[model samples]
Target: MKSHSLDLKSELLAANAMLRTVIDENPNIILMKDWDGKFLIGNRALADLYGTTPENLVGKDDGAFNPNTEQVDFFLKNVRSIMSQTETQVVLEESTNTTTGEVSYYQSIKKPITTADGKKQILVIANDVTELKRVQKRLEESERRLNYVLDATREGIWDWDIPTGIVTHNHRWCVIAGLDDNYLSHPLETFVGLLHPDDSADVKERLQSCLAGTAPYRSEHRICLENGSVFWVLDRGDVVERNDEGVPLRMVGSFVEVNDRKKTEQALAMQSQLLNAIFELSPDGFVSFDEARRVSYVSPAFKRMTGIDFSQVNGLDEVAFTDILVDLCLPTGKFRGFDALRKKRVTDKSGGREFIEVVHGGKRILEVGLRSSEASMVSQILYFRDVTHESEVDQMKSEFLSTAAHELRTPMASIYGFAEVLLTQELDAESSKEFLSIIFKQSGLMASILNELLDLARIEARRGKDFVFEVAHVQALIEETVHGFKQPSWREAPKLVLPVESLYIKADQKKVQQAFLNVLSNAYKYSTATSQVTIELITTPFAAGVGRRIGIRFIDQGIGMTPAQLERVFERFYRADTSGNIPGTGLGMSIVKEIIELHDGEIELSSNAGVGTTVTLWLPLIG
Candidate 1:
């Protein structure tokens, strides 16, 4: 009976120790406080939030640590109400750190509890939501800005599916075009039918030219309604999407009503305001020429796009203006089309030469268009549209397809060669099994490469939109990753040297774990059994700027890479040592880079030919 009593006491002590570890290790705050606002229980996280220890918070209330008495009173009032409740309640609670004055938000679940001593208290479990709140507020601000832009412009936005000849319009389109609310869908012919007889042919020609890529769609034409009503509108559009055959797949544009605007008292004021908004907000740059056909005004976007300021080019003729821009463009870009308008006056209403590609600084692709007439004041306008992203997308797609084909063919050839050898030759059981094994391994390698390619594609396309981001404690994540990691050749496990202070980040737990696992796996895979792999939290700044990232560095004493190999580490399907002994799909580092960059993080690596390699992942700290 005495021995049993001792064992029970031992079990009770063990349980208490486990409970303490659980409470303290949690990043979230957990605590219990009595109805009088005095603290009864506090975890390490809750104490740290107050810049104190748990023992110091045992009997103190908010007033003991918080200097903001009003905020403290408000908090205590809520605590009292929560303690008074009969059932559990959920609320979003906010707290401010007295030491740093940093505000934090939490989604807390508070439950009314009765302690073992018959004391009534409130138990709280709070998850950090400060980052989430910040993101939500930013989204709200962006939506408000978009609302103002759309409402202020009063333009009807429309998208056209060229292949299907279907048109979709914003709500404002109907009022501008004097259309009935009867149609759920409108065909391209519906819009074409509304064009005035005199203007219909010109409009068709412009649309055809835009579709053919000979000219951009910009026309002011009269619209004829069914009731014999006529109105004028500014119609502008661009082919936003195209297929591999260079055929347009989709076009998006806008319509602005200008019917009888010349007679309105507010016409000049409205046009001036709209023009100012365009010059300020539009991503496309514009350069205006006066009656003398000299560079008179340069939009802000023009300066940003071409680095040519109005002050520098004001009162300059066409020849001088083109010279400045041509200097910024490559000689091979065939930017000489602007010479067509060098001699023409501002009143020359003919179609200025269509878009001629101008490669800016050999990095950006700009499509330049010239118009002889814009407004009465501005006689000639030069428009510049940056097509760099579109151009890169095309190049990327081409490279992806070609690279995938070349990489996949190697494994397929092995599979085919091995199967052919097995079928044609009369082999013993051992040889047949070896051949079959070879085939199976190659097939598995192919699957891995395909899966990696798909993952890379999905990541690039969505750009972290599908990520479920949350507060991720780095130490716990690394421990979890290393605990499950293993390799046949790696005799020793990777050693972890972590910081004493907690390091936290907003991350997708699974993705970050995958990234850690990949890095650790590479460290072990490339190294010999006796080689050591070490991981530690680096407190130093990885980059310069405010809110710089913290590094989680992994160092491996393995067969390192040469400088040439290191340069291509993040290239898809690149292997430092392609010798089949070091097995890999070669896409691991590339995938790691894409994942890190999408998370607003960076990966830095250094290696020597005979020495070892060190990889550091720089991630933004949140808590």
Candidate 2:
């Protein structure tokens, strides 16, 4: 009996030590319940959680601490479940207090506790999961909202598991594809089969490219519905996940029906193409100019006629080609020659005439006359023919007439000689002197007419002459030209203005001087006697990629030409109605244009009928 009592004491001590360790080390709310649902043992955690001590909790019904009826019932149910199964386990939800009136969530599990003699009690283990449960509820709400939005918008959402070729579609996605709920479970190929046959290959290629990571997965294609109707859909997707090797593992995307919008766009594109065709195919040259007189559009005929490509000429100001027109017109100051030809509405005939002279392959050619429309305020269309041969023939006719007049003058001279011999026999000294003076004057007039005819012929034939290029000081050129014009021959004295210093330009000196002289002379001749012809020399920067250029402007308060006259001012032999009896060869402006162009510079002319005219020149500045 003594040995048995010692053994019993040792066993009891060990049990107490084990219980103490569990109470100290266990984080859970450990407790023991009897078959009557009375708490027999409780750990420190359980006591603290329930606002009681372990000793106070002993032999107390759970109702002593767990005041909540649902919690008590839950505990009882778990205890009963464990006891009935002899080792059954169950989870129970319970609320416990941490501070006054502060409740927390907990999950409790109870299991059967077997005694050494095989009788059963209950052991319950509880864990805190309040924060976890709250987070879970939040996530569920967010998902619900997202799903509601997608459904409301009718966007067909889908997910694809690339490795397994499995696709899941939302209800709307299935409905859009003319499928039922089972569509989510179907193979992805099922949807591909619904694509229009003509688009199937392209769709497959795009999808494969996306899967291979070569391109983004996006496409619009027509889908054939169950009822044999078709609709266009815009599908967009990107890989959402990748494997270790960077291969696509999953993709999520959405589809939207765009049949109506696509159809409308197609129709509009067709109409635009039709309009463009009509504009391109029209026989007449079509052009549009902006307010700045820059060429906005030019048709094919315009390009062909001018030997200027639209691509090269577009965006260039109309005044930029003043030199080109002048070269063609080959005009004198008073009557400039034609520069180009155009077909005119001459009593229903489509005949064209050439205007100006042009150099082609080192030979001069004249452009025939052509009709032009004067409807546009800043632009005109010209139609003309090549009249180089015809002009030559006309020149030959003039030379023949001059020769005939010269031959007739000799016979008349002989008659005058014999008549003079008869008159000398009977005339007084004063009368003889007068008769001889008259005869000399008539001979001089004939000589002057012959000289003018020869000069005209030479000018017509020499239209294709090559120009000598040289570096010329633009400011000095103007000053020199103005100084020369200061001769008493000029009816009106004009004011000459120069830049502060000399500015050099790349051009032929003589030709440029001639051009300057012509313009100044015109200004002086046309201006009111009291009004000053302001020759202003100003320079400003131009866009030259690396640096800037110098621009020169000449402003004059002269008798400016009307719009009708300005339009034809650059034409060969073209003189304004106001230029009547003006002592000028219309070719002066034409030559000015040619010289400036040979220097690769630009000139612009702007004038109002009564206001004045402003001529601006742009030339590259020397380094």
Candidate 3:
């Protein structure tokens, strides 16, 4: 019996030792309070919090240890609530002041306990939650600030889950699509369906390429909204989350509105295309240079006009280009340097027109325009056109007006002098008849001059537009023109030299006859009565590629003109015989020259001062 009691006592002491070990080494505040709010038990944590040993707070209330009355009262109130609760347990969040004057938060769980005497007591267990609460507050603040920034920028944010084909987008994403952002998760089709049909394929291809790692994740494409309006957006993203195998798992990106910028770019592109079309269609030459003065562009007309290989001339300095143009212009005698071009102003007021004469297949007068490109400040532009024919016509008109005035004055003076004498002075019948005859002759001369002038003007003005061009035997046309001069009163007729075979040529019958008549009349007027003008047919080269030309030669043995007078023979109303004895208007040779030129024929006249004159005419023969 004695050994049994000893074993029981030993077991009881072991159980009490384990209980003390658990209470003394606990990490939490473990304590108990009576219904009166006096402490019945205290652990090491509670003693440490109060800056005292567990024995010091064995039966003390919080008021005995804590100096702050509010904390003590709060602790007592929680204890009383737990003791009074009919329920099993109660939990409360409470605060306490430490010995270091730092306030820390705790989650306290309390339960009512019945002692052996059947009195109710409160048991409290508290856990520190100060650091956890502080971290949570900070995170909430950061999230709020981030959302604020995103909303302010109105950025459309998207998070795509690759494997699931699901997407989570922010409120702004739906707003951009003109939809309500009531839900967060959507199918990938929700966004993809909004792409314009024209851009859908390209966007898909780009996205697939990026997802496959063949290209970067960026795109600019057109997207259609719910309102049926299309907008341009620039989408950019990166693989934010990837699997362990290096495959993309998720992607996050943004969509930025770029419609205005895209419209501007399209406008510029259309303008560029139109500008190029204008350059291509223009008959005039165009050249442009960049900021470095390098040849940036050359039109097709410019290449043809200059006949310089653009490959060789492109990127050359302005001086080199000038040298090339000057060399091409050497035959035309209008060489100019780059300095001259630089000196010209490029404004509407100035027009910047400069004449550059160049001989390509023929003499060409270039009216070049210079201007700076407003689109690019450092660039320059040049526009050139061939104006050779226009310039020559203007000069011819001016000369005709001057010479006509001079030629008409002589006959008018003669008529006036003779008529004045007949009207004012008394004379015999024979003298009066002689004076009247002179007046009639002068009037007839004036009429002839006016008629010839009118004929030349009409022919030139029509310029073959109304002429009937036909293929006729060359020899027949010559014979027909010679027959008009076959009058019975002539001292000698021109000798017609014929070719054994017939030659055909394109010519107008009446104009050809008129041309030959002027030539024959000149031959007869300048030569003596017995002089014979021989006409001959011959062949010679026309131009570079044009085949043989038919030549008709008219040789005269009359008093010929000096070199000075010969040069002016084709001038309208310019007569070699300055003494008014010649009975012809000086417009005959000019008319003859114009008619020949209109037929695409050339005339050559060689004269000796007193010996004779030789006139040869060349016309292109028909095939």
Candidate 4:
């Protein structure tokens, strides 16, 4: 009996030794809890982690270390799940602290522990994952930001496996081709097939060069889509890895759609061609100079007319030409001793001088006239014409017109005023009516001729001044102007349509009224008796200085002018037909143009001879 008792004690001692060895060697935290959730056994690692000996921890509930009841409840829930066979293994994230107050992340797992007699307990294992969690979070954040940048810039990302010819593309790459995410794992041949036939060879060659390590893999090519549309693509990539034989093993690249940029380049190329044509074919000599007066560009005609070689004169400053001209003028007070040159006047020689003259080239003498744009205090553009023949003709015409106008104005005014007075006097009723009609018609004819002469004089003398602007109701102005044209002699009164109520516009009221009346009268005279005349008022918004602005549009429909008539419609006294059949002085449109411009507004006319005409007037709406 003594020997048997000693043997049993030794077996128990051996079992305890094995359990201690197992617990100490465990990489994870190992602990045992009783049914009441008290720590009954703890490994050396768990004891060391809590800064306590295993003996002291054995009888303590989790409150001794974890402290928080919530934490204890969480732990108990997992223990109960394992004990009830609801879960064979459970994982949870828990926060814990060592004696140093340093926070740590732990991935805790719980499992059921049963005694040989089948009484259940809880076994908990915890793995430290603080550094791993931090690294994972950082990686996820980096990926998110990278995706954001790619999305914002509309960049397409791709990866190519050189060995297998398998291509993987991100969603954006598909979107760029007007597709969806259904072709990510498509073969490289699928991409190659989409390339324009003309661009395919160059692209393949570039790829081959990259694979052979002979060049960087970058290229631009035109790509065709399934929808029969084409786009430009900028492909860029690098070799990610290489085999011992120097062949690329893996490659990565991006596809950026550059179709818009390509279109812009093509448009610029066309514009350059147009400019080149203009420079080569233009009759007038065109030149541009920098602020320093160095000639930057000159048309082909300029080179021919000056007899100065471009290579020798390209960078020559305008000061050099001015100095030469000044020297010539000082000696002869003329350009090469020409009489007309001597008669030229310089208003403010500080800017420059422009006049007509005859210049003598060494081989041939040519007549040249110069009229300059308003130059800055330092720079000028001198446009010249060969006007030797035109000057003589203009002088003769000017003298004849001056004499003729003086003689015609006196008789025309008397004919117009005297007839009006005689027609208004008493006479027999039948004779009175007939005579009045004749007088009225003759007076209108005379007035029309006088008005045309006056308009011609105004244009020749440049007598118009800027308009006076004021706030006025456009609706009221329109009504007044239309009322003035309401005479009873017409076959039928034209229809007047005003769609909207009163609208306020910022413009010169008198000038606006005159313009509206001219347009309305023209429409009435040209249209059939039954034709309708519509005037529409529309408003729109525009941007102003740190605020908003309103724009008013006046649209009209009536008998339209022909294309040729429209072209010269605004020229003073320029009648479309001069047969004296159309009752117009021809000065109305010209005056209308001058007034509208003075008010800083715009007028546009669209017309078809038979269909109808529409005049659109735009004026600012002011408060």
The best candidate by TM-score is 1
TM-score of each: 0.52, 0.30, 0.48, 0.34
Question: Which stretches of candidate 1 lie above 4 Å from their native place?
Answer: 1-267, 289-296, 311-324, 338-363, 372-380, 423-426, 499-503, 540-550, 621-623
Worst 10-residue lDDT window for candidate 1 reads 139-148
Q: Which residue pairs in candidate 1 collide?
A: none
Residue 23's lDDT in candidate 4: 41
Supply candidate 1's per-residue lDDT for 445: 91
For every candidate in turn, the CA RMSD to the true structure comes to: 33.5, 43.8, 40.7, 35.2
Please name the candidate that would achieve the greatest lDDT relative to the true structure: 1
TM-score pick, better of 3 and 4: 3
lDDT of 4 at 481: 72
Q: Cα lDDT of model 4 overall?
A: 0.58
lDDT value, residue 264 of candidate 3: 40
The per-model lDDT (C-alpha) reads 0.72, 0.59, 0.69, 0.58
Tell me the TM-score of model 2.
0.30
Q: Encode model 1's per-residue lDDT on 101-194: one tens digit a residue.
A: 8888876666665532245677666766675542221100000000001112246888999999999887788877777565425999999999
Which of candidates 1 and 3 reaches a greater TM-score?
1
Candidate numbers sorted by TM-score from highest down: 1, 3, 4, 2
> Per the 3 Å backbone cut-off, how many clashing residue pairs does candidate 2 have?
46
TM-score of 1: 0.52
> 2 or 3: which has the higher lDDT?
3
Count of steric clashes across candidates, in order? 0, 46, 0, 0
- Write candidate 4's Cα lDDT for 269-329 as tens digits: 4334323533343333544444466655555755565544456556667656444434423
Arranged by lDDT, best first: 1, 3, 2, 4
